[model samples]
Target chain A: MSNPVSERGFEPARHAELALLLEVAGTPKPGNVDRRRDLSGLCFEHFLTGAVGSAAGLRLAEDGAPVGEAFETAVAGMSKQGGGNTQFGCLLLLVPLVKAAVAGDLSPEGATRAAEATTVDDAVSFYRAFEHVDVAVGDPPGDASDLDVRRGSEAESALRAEGLTLSDIMELSAERDANAREWTGGFARTFRAAESILNDEGPVTDRVARAFIDLLTEEPDTLVVTNHGEDVARDVMDRAASVSDLDEAETLAEEFVAEGINPGTTADIVCAATFVALERGVPL
Target chain B: MSNPVSERGFEPARHAELALLLEVAGTPKPGNVDRRRDLSGLCFEHFLTGAVGSAAGLRLAEDGAPVGEAFETAVAGMSKQGGGNTQFGCLLLLVPLVKAAVAGDLSPEGATRAAEATTVDDAVSFYRAFEHVDVAVGDPPGDASDLDVRRGSEAESALRAEGLTLSDIMELSAERDANAREWTGGFARTFRAAESILNDEGPVTDRVARAFIDLLTEEPDTLVVTNHGEDVARDVMDRAASVSDLDEAETLAEEFVAEGINPGTTADIVCAATFVALERGVPL
Candidate 1:
C-alpha cells in the first residue's frame, strides 16, 4: 500500500484497521460479524449506503415496502441536507474510487500517469476515475421536486428500506453559505477507499510505522531529499500539523501516530515510504 | 470489518476497491519529506497546492523563481487529451473537497454531524460549512504563494523526479477506456467496485477483490435488504428472470459482487449482513 504515513508518521492503527476490515469482509463461512463494528453502531459503510438512498430520494411505495420518488426527489434527498446530512455527500464522492479499482480503472500505468501528470485537471481526472461514484452520482445534486409532505415521507421510507439513511448524506449545502470560498462549489465530497484498502479503516502499529517516524523533523525543508527520507518527512509534518499544538519535536512525532492521520493522505505516504525503504535497502 | 464472501455463496467482487490503489501507488520518495507512502506521488500535492493558488490567486514575490507559475504552467503543459479540458464543469467540483481538507475549513464536528444526517436537507447546514467562507473574514483558499515552488530547475525538476516515466503515464491513460464507463462523468450510472470489477476486470478472488466488484452496483437496497441469503437469492432471481439465464441463483450471487455496487450500498450491506451473521456467531 502507499504510505499515508510518509509525511506524518507510521501508524499500526492503519494495519489494524485493514486487518479488522479484511478479517470481517470475507464470507460467512469465515466467521461471524461483531456488533460493535456491525449495524448497531454507524460506521463509514452504513453512513455511505444511507447517504445513497437519501441522495436519490427513494421513497416507499403505497404498499408496505418503499418506492423510489422522482430522481429529483432522490437528488434532493442527497443534496438538500438540512442539519445532519453528510452520508450522501461523503458517499457520493467515495464509492467511485472503489469502483475505479474494481473496474481496473486504476492500473500501475494509470497511477503512474497520475503521478507524473503536471496538470491539476489530469490529476483530478486521474483521481476522479478512482472516486466513489454511487455516492457521487447515485444521488446527484439538484433534487428539488415540488412534492408534498406525505409523498416525501414515502420516498424517504423507500430509500430507508434499502438501508439508505437520510442522516449520512453530504448536503453540499455549503453552496449556500455566503461566507464560502470559491472552492465551495466543489465542497461536496465522498469517502471512496483507495484501491488497496477498501473499507480499510485506520492504522495501528507496524515496522513501516516505527521506521518512518524515527525520521521526521519540525522543519520540513531542512530534511534530506533521499527517496524515503524526504517524502516521509513531509507526510509526518502534515499529519503533525493537522491537530492541536505539539510544542516540541518529540511531542509532534508522538501525536502523529496517536491521533492517527487522514486515511487518504497518510496511507499513501506511509505505504510509499515503506516501499522506498525496502526498495532502496534502507537499513531501517 | 465486513464480509467479502457471503454465506449465500461466493459473491462477486463488490465496490470495495481501495486496495487497487495500493497496487499502483508505488513507493516513491520526493525531497525533504518524512513519514511514508509518497505512494500517490508528491507531484499531486504540488499540483493541488497550485490549484489552491489558482483559487486564491495570491502572488508572493519569491526570489527570481517563476515558482508562482510552476504548477499553473505544469497544468497548462499537459495535452488537453485531444479535446477535453479539466478546468471547467464537473472537473471543478473537487476544488471544494480538496480545499476544505487542506485548509481545514470543513469542521470535523460539523462533518461528523452531517455524516450522520438522515435527510439531504437536514445535512445541508453541515455541508455548507465547507463552502461557507466569510469574504474577508474567512480563510480564503491559499494561493500559489502558499505553494513552495522554488526558484531553480531543481525545484521543478524534483517535482516529478522519480523512477516514473512518461510512457508509464501514457500506459495508464490508455487503460482508461477499458475501465472508465465514460470519458466524461466516469461512473455516472453504476458506481460499485464489484460492477467495475466484473465489467472491466474479470473475476473476484479476494475479499478485497469482491468488495471492489460489489462497489459498482450503486443500489443501497441490495446492501441493506438483500444482504441476507433470502434477499440475495430473490434479487438474483429477479435479475435472472429479466434476462435469459437458468442458473439465476448462482449468477445472482456472483452478480452482487460485480464491481459497480454503490459504496453506500456496499457499506450498509457489509454492515448489515455481517451484523446478522455475527448475531448468529458464525466464525471465520
Candidate 2:
C-alpha cells in the first residue's frame, strides 16, 4: 500500500481500486451512479463492493495471470457482493490496463500490446466472466457465429472452435462497444482523457467530472443506445457536448436520470482514464 | 485482498481504507468533509491521500506490531502526503482495534485489553505522532507535568521519565478528548455504534450517517468545544439531536459549515465503529 521498498515494485491493484473509488466518489457525474445520487437497483455501495471485490484478482494480473482470468474472478467476487452489474465495463477496461501497468508500461501502446496478446484461454475466461452478472453488451455483428453472451460456456466453445482470441472477439465488437473500441484501437480516447485529467485545473473529483462530460460528449453511449435507441443516445451526447457549466450538467443529469438515459459506457471510460492518471502519479 | 484461503486471515488494511472512504463519501455529513462539501484548508483529496498513506502501517499493526509504532508510522506517512491531520483520531482508535482484530478480538473488552497492553515506548511513539499534524486537543490538566502536545519530543521525554504507558497518557487526556475517552473507556460507544450498524436495515452509508448523527447528538463534540466553546458545542449537539430528517440535517449542515463547527471526534468514533462492523461481517 505504501511505496514499495523491495523488489515487488508498484502495486497496480491499489492503484486500480483507488481509481475506481475516485471515479465513483466524483460528485455531479451526470447520469452515472456517483456520490451525489444512487439509482434504485444500482446503489453507490455496490460499486464500493465491486472495487474491493476486484482488488485481489486485479493484482493477480501483475503476477502474469491471463487478464481474462482476473476479469472472471473479479466479476464472480462482485456478484457475490450483490445482484447487479455496477462496474462490468470498468472491470473490462482495467484488467488489461492493470496487466500493462504490471509490465511497467501504461501508455496506449502498452495497453494495445497487452490486449493484442490475449489467448484463446483468455477468450474462454472472458466468456466465463459474463456468467455472473447481466453486463449490457450490444447484439453481436450479423457475421459472428454463436456469439450470444448468455450462452456462457456454449459461447466459449464456439469461440474456441473458431480459434478466436479475446482480442479477436473485441475487434469484432469494436464497431459497437466503446470499451472494445478502446481495446482494439489502442485506448486512444482514454489516453487523451488521461492526459487532460493530469493537466486539469481543479480538484481530482472536478477533473473527473469534466473528463466524464468530455467523454460523454464525444461518443453516443452504447448502453443508452441499447436501452433506449440510437437517436436518444446521440441526443445525450449532444446535450453532454453543450454543457459548459456543471450546474447546467446537473440539471441535465436530473432529466437524464428521470428518462433512464445513463451514459454508463462513458463512465466506464472515465474509470479507465482515472486509472491512467493515477498510474502516472498525478497528485490526485 | 481476498478472504483467507490459507493461514493469512482477513486483511484489515483494505477494510480500514474502505471505512475511511465510506465515511468521507457519506453525503451531507454536516460540518465535516463529506462528498457534498470540502472545507477550505482540508479538501477531500487530502483525506484520500491520508487514507492511502496510512494503509501500510495499519497493516503492520495487524501483523502484531506495537500499536504506537503503527500510529507514528501512519501519522508520519499522512504528514508526508500533506500538511493536515485528516484522520488522526481515527488512527488512534483503529491501531489498537486492528491489533485486537489480528488477535481475533474486536469487541470493547478486546480493544480494552489491547489498549491496556501498551508500553512506555508506545507512549513515546504516541507523543511523536503529534509532531506530524496539528490535531485538535484541549489544554492538559493543570496538574500534569510536561504534557503539552506542542512540545513533541520534549513531552515524550517527560512521559518516559514519568513511566507512563500510552494508555496512562490516554487516561490523563480522556476527560477532554472524546477519542482519548474511547481509549480509556474501552471504546464503549464505538462498539455500541458497531452493533447498531450491524442491526440497521439499510445501505451501509445510510447506517453510517445515522450512527454519526446519533453519536453527535450524544456527545457535544470535544473538537467543536475546543474551537467554539462549550455552549456552542452543546447547542450543536441539541441541533444534531433534533434531526429526525436527513434533509433537515443537510440544511443544518450548511449552517454548521458556515459557522465552522466541525464534529471531528464523532467522525472518528464512526470510523472505529465502521471497522468493528466490517470486522464482524457487516454486509458493507
Stretches of candidate 2 off by over 4 Å are: A1-11, A142-147, A153-156, B1-11, B76-83, B141-147, B151-160
Q: How big is the positional error of residue B231 in model 2, measured in Å on the Cα after superposition?
A: 2.8
- Candidate 1 lDDT, tens digit per residue, A1-284? 11111111111212112222222221110001111122212222322222323322222111111111222232333332121222322222222222222334333332222222222222222222222122211122446321111233334433344332221121232232111111122211111112222222222113333322322223332112221245654665565444332134235434433433222222223333322222222221
The superposed Cα distance between candidate 2 and the true structure at residue A193, in angstroms, equals 0.7
What is the DockQ score, from 0 to 1, of model 2? 0.23
Pick out the ten consecutive residues of candidate 2 chain B with the lowest summed lDDT: B1-10
lDDT of 2 by residue, A1-284 (tens): 12212111126776776677778877678888887788877888777767766766777776778988988877776665553787788888999999899888898889999999999988888887787777776676666648766567678778878898999889888878889999999999899999989999777778898899988889899888888889999999889888997778888778888888888988889989988888886764
Count of backbone clashes for each model? 215, 0
Error of 2 at B224 (Å): 1.6
lDDT of 2 at B38: 87
